[model samples]
Target: MNKAQVVEAVVLAKKAKQLTWESIASTLGMSTVWVTSACLGMNSMPEQAAEKLCELLELPSEAKSVLMEYPTKAWSPAIPQDPLIYRLYEVVGVYGDTLKEVIQEKFGDGIMSAIDFSMEVEKQPDPKGDRVVITMNGKFLPYKAW
Candidate 1:
């Protein structure tokens, strides 16, 4: 089966089993974000992890190998259409330069490495309104200059 089908099966199984990403990650002995991304086809899991996840989900045999295969990551829209996604796009449009400048100032001439990145999303309770908090940590890759 293709990665998309595998992801579909994973989602179905997750819902059917009422399993949290944290729980699955614990089973795989990995991070929640990485495990979730792997299941969603953005990253590849190791063979052992893939087998364990497939067994946990009771997925088709084809799913195990697919889950361990490297993925070619791409997004459909150049500019996102969904409201939440578009909001993130807008945030980049508005603060991209400021963020880049600050990051460079702090870290030197370097870029964040998505390949070695981790992200966490949390909900903060507030009296008037709850807040969505996102934290991203990544290795910094500096330019190789002569």
Candidate 2:
């Protein structure tokens, strides 16, 4: 099936199961807006996100594998005008610089490449402040010349 059909199917199933977008988004560690846009076909699902969605929705193995296939193009030709992606962009616009600086400080001169990483999160309790600790491990591979 196509992306839109997959999205529509998931949304329909979610509604029938009385599931909330917040629940799904939190489970996926994504913003509700992003999940919503993906469900409505306004945004394409990245492979990782698509795999998570397939698992959450209890799709068949074939469908799950299909959803995880890499797309031919890096970016979709049809950019979303959805409020969700727009709001995400607004958040990036406002806080992206601060986030970048913090990330650089923590990781030194490189990025945490999503393609080569694993992430785990845990909740830690403290008297002063409760914290959600996220640990990401990635292979540190420098770019090489051909």
Leading candidate by lDDT: 1
lDDT of 1 at 53: 98
The per-candidate count of clashes, in order, stands at: 0, 0
Write the residue-wise lDDT of candidate 1 on 1-146 in tens digits: 99899999999999999999999999989988889999999998899999999999899999999999899898786897889989999998999999899999999998999988899878899999999998999999998889
Cα-based TM-score, every candidate: 0.91, 0.44
lDDT of each: 0.93, 0.67
Per-residue CA lDDT of model 2 for 81-145, tens digit only, reads 89876775777689888876777776665555655655555679989999767566666544455
- Cα displacement (angstroms), candidate 1, residue 68, comes to 0.3
Top-scoring candidate (TM-score)? 1
Task: Please report how far candidate 2 places residue 52 from its true position, in Å.
Answer: 12
Candidate 1 residues lying further than 4 Å off, grouped into runs, are none
Model 2 residue 64 lDDT?
Answer: 52
Model 2 segments more than 4 A misplaced: 20-65, 71-85, 116-146
